[model samples]
Target: MKTDSRWITTPITADLLRGALDLERTEHGVLPHRLPARARAQCGDPQLAMVESQPSGVRLVFRTRATAVELDTLPTKRLYVGAPARPDGVYDLLVDGTLAGQGSVSGGTVQVVDMSTGSMELRPGPVGTLRFTGLPGRDKTVEIWLPHNETTELAELRTDAPLTVAPDPGRKVWLHHGSSISHGSDAASPTAIWPALAAALAGVELVNLGLGGSALLDPFTARAVRDTPADLISLKLGINVVNADLMRLRAFGPAVHGFLDTVREGHPTTPLLVVSPILCPMHEDTPGPTAMDLSALGAGRITFVATGDPAERASGKLTLNVVRDELSRIVAQRAAEDPHLHYLDGRALYGEADAAELPLPDGLHPDAATHRRIGERFAELAFADDGAFAGSGGERRAGGR
Candidate 1:
């Protein structure tokens, strides 16, 4: 039996973990991975902070095939823990309720923070270890919850508890990558991130690798996606690469081809959706800005500017439109030969229609409501039952960088 097989066994009981907090019943003494907030509330655990916003112990939890697990397999599954409500610059992680992984952050760091319990501390943000564990037998579903943000998890149940469920197994898996916008920008809750929301609406499993500022088409990233196990996949490209003005046309074109080529190498016929960036008026046609400018918002500090006229948007000179055009053209050409390959224009996902009414809060990244709308549109277009993508696993599972 492979370590990370998608044959998940859930309806897991709280007795699986011996932690401080007692888990409330998920369908009574069991919790599945797709525990929605409402379900969590009903189960009494809430599953809220357990995802991202919650502290170290429960930020996120996953079932592992590790008996005495050695970390990593295939594409690598890493946990990204962010700074918590109280920044200690250090935090500890307990796997199966024992101190395991650890990293630390500096005090008062603005963008990201860290947490510490015992000697272990977790990484602040954007990056962290890609981990794997082995929990053998029909038992699946590990528990996660931070001590401070601690809510009850199924693991807190009594030992020798009854197996809540065996397996039904119909859910598909989703693979996605993008920028900070996709990572979860202004969303109020961690679970409310567009991808999370989309996953809920679609009823599929998800593996999200949306690095905030790091979706630069690195070969490593492409390789990561290619080798991982997924029923369906999508890449929300262009925006961040353009906003950062990170690469030029000469390199961008080849990068897109190479990125797809790498993935096709592994999952050649798997449903692959390559989506271009959504609209951003400022840098749509303009080369994005090089130096940070803050006068627009009238703020003192100058951060990266995402919008401006085509010529003046950036000194380094890459625009959102240029990247999106290049990306779409590449995907379209590929689709001609590969029936499984598909292209979704970002605008089709979220376009001028939306911009007219729901302007982006900061001229970049959508607010929560916009995220919902984008999710809805994506679900409508990509998973329209009769669409080419009906088999593509499109249940509002797309957002931008």
Candidate 2:
């Protein structure tokens, strides 16, 4: 057997990972989780369990002079039967704080779930390798951001030279929570997720708690955010609640209050931003327990349609318009006493005009281009001078001006 004598392999451990709250060592490798063990134990929903384990803002960071790097991963890919196949998850390689390369590993196991029948099937596949060669010859910091939509198990890291853990950049950490939009739905790559993009634009570290179909105002999630250390915090509320039909007006207002209260208990003076949902034409005036359009699915496309009646709003059902109004009022009332608490109408990021030009392809989540637009807009609105989170110990450029 021909053996390469110059390769050095390092076991991926918690020390090499950032933006992850916990790591679970598995038989094959280490799995990074966004939620701590205690918080994970409090939830019994399988959906939540799955999503919390999907690394959204997690990255493997180290310093090396290696010209070649290889990462072995075992990823659990999801597939929905009778629907369009999803794209392969992408891994982004950043060298010296610049995006240097992008790659994807194939051959991971697939979990096919039939949403109509509620049955799932597991199809085992081989592990795959992601390799990037011809990096700069000098010592430099390297960050490998994992896929946001897939559950990745990091098995081994191999390089041509010795590696050391990268020193923290001392940037302010921004912890954010939202639904699938924040979870990178339709995003092109791991770093393209809106929160990641916004974090880059804002020059802050991101800790994203964006669970798909699972942001139900759960106490554990609020507690998770409460316990995490952060210089800036933002919560994108309302869309998930409205779409999931998780609660009525009566419970939503109080639940929001409780969530904020819990966060405030841990961070009384921290800069906290509360954002409502963007304009979703389907659910703007109508309440929803959003359902799939079967006809569209049969036509080889997927579409979501609001099922609840608009008249239900009169009986206290929640809608996007209702949620936005209520959220604005709540933040305004509290901001008088809490100077650091701030609010941004989500429409400022994406409104009816933007929707007309660039519609949500699925009638819910924004596409990749929209993600870019939102990220850029957020940086301007929330991270600029005199903005809600501006100069709150976050990174700034030049001249103290």
Candidate 3:
């Protein structure tokens, strides 16, 4: 590609970012984080640490007449030591709210994990550039949705024309937190994640806090939600808790209460939706500490199995079914005092029949097709004309201060 002498390079700063909670300056450039530093410091869980920095819903928003743009990034890609290979994460470019192009960058550092051995190793690599050309000639708003699954470090940004911060979409912002299912673990790209898809369909802004393996009803996470501005909120609970066996039925209800109470402090009347876990037969009735199916991994495939016994449920161990029932009951009890609060069975988004049609490929996360299905189903059930979250778009506010 030929560079024009008039091309300009702009420093990528927070002013040009959206949907991110924090940005950390680095030697290479800047790294986006879904969790702020204070909230991140409150947790020591490695899984939480990793996912919060992955930027699941973060993007760069700006306006320019540039017909060509380039972003230098160093992506930290993950690789399971014994599992099959995965492709590079994709970068999606949207012009005037429409997807104009998509591409992926390679040659990034690799974080290799050997689940069998419970060990991790880092392999350093070089940075790569992602380039998009043929953008419209006139100035237009642009959104560069980051990869949902990769940890990316933005090094620099270049364009053929001067750039300025784009105005906000002037829509309601929906803040959602969930497990890997909502993190686009299996989705094709960042914008394809269920929350992103649902937000776009409902014509609202999104602040996805869908940390993979980390939506454990933590107080700090609750506080983060409380501080953030949102017109609507949703919590997709149960899967991570059940799989990790983090808490039993004895403590689950109170945790849920505490989480909701904190958020209510910030947005008492926001349309809050409590969503239970989607269908996962492995942990449906059986308790879990979901274990990797090593036999499957050895065959160049990956799968999971519930390791907890059904008998444990009688001991107050929480299974998906138990959690779902509890969540429904809790919502009903609270709705008496807070009519704005509502509940939706995760199964409604991906129930038994839907699972039968598109079985979970890994017996855990939904596949790409299922991501699309869930996104569409969620939009229909929650954002439709008569839905619980109907008319929930954040009231339009004046653009710019």
Candidate achieving the largest TM-score = 3
Reference-based lDDT, each prediction: 0.52, 0.88, 0.90
The runs of at least 3 residues in candidate 3 whose Cα sits more than 4 Å from the true structure, single-residue gaps closed, are 1-4, 393-401
Model 1 C-alpha lDDT per residue in residues 34-113, reported as the tens digit of each score: 22233334432211223322221123344443333221101111221232243222233445434454433222112222
lDDT of 1 at 217: 80
Cα-based RMSD of the predictions, in order? 13.8, 3.2, 1.9
Clashing pairs in 2: none
Model 2 lDDT-worst window of ten = 392-401
Residue-level lDDT of model 3, residues 1-401, one tens digit each, is 22567668788888888878888998789999988899989888878888998988889999999999999999999999778778999999999999999999999899998989988888999989999999999989989999999999999888988899987667777889999989888898889998999989988788899999888999999998888878888999989999899999989999999999999998899999999999999999999899889999898888999999999999999899999999999999999999899999999999999989999999999988999999999999999788878875545533211
After superposing candidate 2 on the true structure, give the runs of residues whose Cα lies further than 4 Å from its correct spot.
Answer: 1-3, 393-401
Better of 1 and 3 by lDDT: 3
Q: Which ranking of candidates, highest TM-score first?
A: 3, 2, 1
lDDT of 1: 0.52
**Global CA lDDT of candidate 2, please?**
0.88
Residue lDDT tens for model 2, 1-401: 11367889987877788879889988778999998899888988777877888898899999999999999898889997778888888999999889999998898889897777778788988778999998999999999999999899888899999999887777778889898898888899989999999999888888898888877788888888888888888999999898889899999999999999999888788899999988899999999899877778777777899999999999899999999999999999999999999999999999999999999998998999999999998999999898999777634322110
